[model samples]
Target: MAPRANPTLRQRRLGAELRRMREQVGFGGSELGRLVGMSPAQVTQMEAGKIGISVERLRTIAATCMCVNEPLVAALSDIITEREKPGWWEEYRGTLSEDFVDVAEFEGQARRLTTYSMAFIPGLLQTGSYSSAVFAQTFPPLPRHEIDLRTAFRMQRQRVVRSGTTPYAAFIHEAALRMQFSGPTVLAEQLGALIEDSEQSSVSIRVVPFDVSAMPSSSGTFTYAEGPIPELDAAQVDTSLGCRIFDAPAHVARFRSLLARFESRALSEEESRDFIGSVMKEMESKRA
Candidate 1:
């Protein structure tokens, strides 16, 4: 088969796992190639995500490498089986950055989601007008069409939270509550929407008040997506360039710990709802 010119995040992840397994067993590329009836170059290409691996081949590789993690192997097999399926984000593939599409893929496949935001409401919880307003503030001033496209993409991504099946937990800082992205009116509407969403049994919204004596030095926003198996979990963080996804065990663990810290410092769900109501009232009072 011809090598893939560009592989998606999931494809890359499968390749990484295969490479990790081989390394753990102390088998060099040429050595594994001989055992698997492939050339060393073929093994390298598969491990680099440039070439695909069949489920049978994957099983053979796992057996050769002495991997005993049945659950992880099954999860990897599922990924391979779903390789031909296209997600909703495919509609915007050429129009938007691949990173944007990857983020949507990550969120859509997750069993549960946890997010922490310090300066803005989590994208999944943002309302239409609020999201448009946030996009309008892009550093280089995006074209009107580009802004609209981004807003539409973001609104579409909220479906996972709206499905009412996937458990979602968001910890947003008090500072974000007062940012007034578009204005007090839009911010008020956004906060009101948050309260309504929090009413869902599967949704949890917690506010981290400014009064908290200590906050982590890392100010960036991040999301943790729980996979079927702990080893397959992924964490995503936004940077100036774009979203970065981390699936390595160590990175995922650190993100999990960071989210725990955020949760610990945030208000309870009920208290958060009351706090948000008060903020909405403050916004309304300002309008008066």
Candidate 2:
């Protein structure tokens, strides 16, 4: 079979799991290949996510490696199926960065999402004008066309919340709520949209007020996407160069903890709405 030049994160994840199992059993590529009836190069290719593996072969490898985790094996099977499916993000491939499409892939399959933003509302929760305004402020100002493309891409991400199936929990700060991305009118509309979305049974919006006595020193934005299984979860964080995604157990766990800390510092659901309401009123009063 031909090798894949660019494999999705899910495909890579499946290979990673198999590689981990092989390592646990103290088997090298040559040995594993011999046992699995494939060439050593084939094993290497599969491990590197350049080649696909069927569920039956995957199960055989798991058994040979003494991996008894039924749930993990089941999850691997699911990944095999998801790897073949095309996603909506494909339409915007060249229009956006590869990382952007990857982010959509994660969000599309996430069973639950937890995000923490200190300076801006997350893309998934942002309204059209708010997103366009945020893009406009980017340094080395983007071309008008790029700004429109980014805005549209961001708006597409809102389907996660609009679907009303995946549970979404966002922890935003007071500063973000006050930041007039597109002046008072647009900011007010953005915050109002947030308030309305918060009413969804599956969506939760929490605010971390500036007056809080003690809070974590860390200031960054991250999204933790939980898959059907815990081991498949991933975390995406913004970086100077671009967005970075982490699925390794250690990285994912740290992000999960970081988000939890942010959540703890945020106001309760009911209180968060009241806080947002006050901010909305403040904005309106300023306009008067």
Candidate 3:
């Protein structure tokens, strides 16, 4: 088969794992190629995710590299098989940035999602108006048609929540809760929806109050998308530059640790609901 123009993160991840495994075992491209019955060029193509690898070949490489982790092997196999399936986000290919589509595709496949946001409501929980307000504030501002497309795209991403099967935990700071994205009414609706959504068995929303003594030293927003197995777990963080996906063992572990810290410091789920309710009431009073 021909090479993919743009491989999904999961596809790249599989290739990356193969390369890492081989290197860790001191196997070179030609050496590994001989063992896998592929030429060095073919092995390079597979490792670059420019081409696909058969499940049997992948297992051979894993075993040759001395990787005995059954779960990891199974996870890789699953990813290889799943790669052939097209994702819903693929429909937006020509319209949105590849990074945005990648994020959506990642969310769809994630078994569980944990996110922390300080400046704005996390996208999964954001209301239509709130998200529009956010896009409206973007620098070099987009055209109206573009803004509408982005808003719709974001709302589409919330389908995972509607499914009510994927586990989601959002750690939003009080500052984000207090910010009136479009206006008091919009923010109020957003917070109210948050409270209601928190009641879902699959969703957990926690608030980090301003009174908290310590906060995550690192700032900005991030989402940790857990995979079927630890090896496939990844963290997506947005920066001024653009979105970055972290999947290295060390990077994933650090993000996981940071999320744990936020979870411990944030309010209990019940308390958080009450806190949001109180904020909604305050918004009402201000508007009155």
Candidate 4:
């Protein structure tokens, strides 16, 4: 009834671009509605990307927005094609957070990903037990079913590495390494896994040492992803309410700055490898 209640990134993008173009033309929503032979509310919904427009109608709207250039049309066509394709994550609906699904879908299509985590290891590097521990801490009273579902969702998301098509880079704070979520054994196992994952040629892991007090990203974790097309980049900052996604150049630039600052303080790959091994050894010492 509500147009299937789902839209692909491509569809969403095409709809967003069209909405932006419409607003740029100085036509009031009502006026545009009059022009497009739709109601003012419908025009607003269309511009807000709550619904889709047929190709012919989209072209007409583009013409009205004065963005009828061939290149613009070509980009729209590309988005449509992408939207028409079925995504792999669609089957996991109702089980994962909408934010999780959105992030995963975007990551799947992304060509590159950069993330900074000061409190915990980025989700990509988290082991199943580590993830479960983190989630438990967040929703300590959640039902077992919900916890299992969330953990499973996270593991499924980790399949990004298994995909072997796109690669990502992660930077974490040394504090994250020291923060023991589970008992020593679980923490030790997860730390060991991080070292193994870092061995992959495509992924890069760096750690900002505890002494680096001036590093950025002290507020919370955030991620930036670049799709195959530069124009498709999206930045996400985590918040207690949920994730806030930023596509504007200004926001993305700020996140990039945070990453650069953290990178400046982070240990080199070899140094981090040593640090990881050392942490594992410490866990072993505790066992002994």
Clashes of each: 0, 0, 0, 0
Candidate 4 residue 20 C-alpha distance from true site, Å: 2.7
Per-residue alpha-carbon lDDT of candidate 1 for residues 161-246, written as tens digits (9 for 90 to 100): 99877899999899889998788989999999999999999899999998987777663698999989999999999888898888
Q: Which portions of model 1 miss their true places by more than 4 Å?
A: none
- Expressed as tens digits, the lDDT of each residue in 1-288 for candidate 3 is 887888877778888888989998999999999987899998888888889988998898999999999899998998777636587889999789988898898899899999999998999999999999999998998899999999999999999887897899999999999988677888888988899899999999999999998786765799999999888899999887678888889999999899989978999999999999999999878777
Each candidate's lDDT (Cα)?
0.91, 0.87, 0.89, 0.76
Clashing pairs in 2: none
Worst 10 residues of 1 by lDDT: 212-221
Better of 3 and 4 by TM-score: 3
Q: What is candidate 4's lDDT per residue for 1-288, written digit by digit as tens?
A: 365366655556666667667777888888888997988877766655677677788778888888856666766666555544456677776666777777777677677888888788888889999999888887447777777877887788777875656687888777788788877788888889999988888888988778877665345688888754555567877888777677665676777777777777788988999998898888877877
Instruction: Estimate TM-scores for all models.
Output: 0.95, 0.93, 0.95, 0.87
| lDDT minimum window of 10 residues, candidate 2 | 78-87
> What's the residue-level lDDT of 57 in candidate 4?
83
lDDT of 1 at 56: 98
lDDT of 3 at 120: 89
Displacement of residue 154 (Cα, Å) in model 3 is 0.7
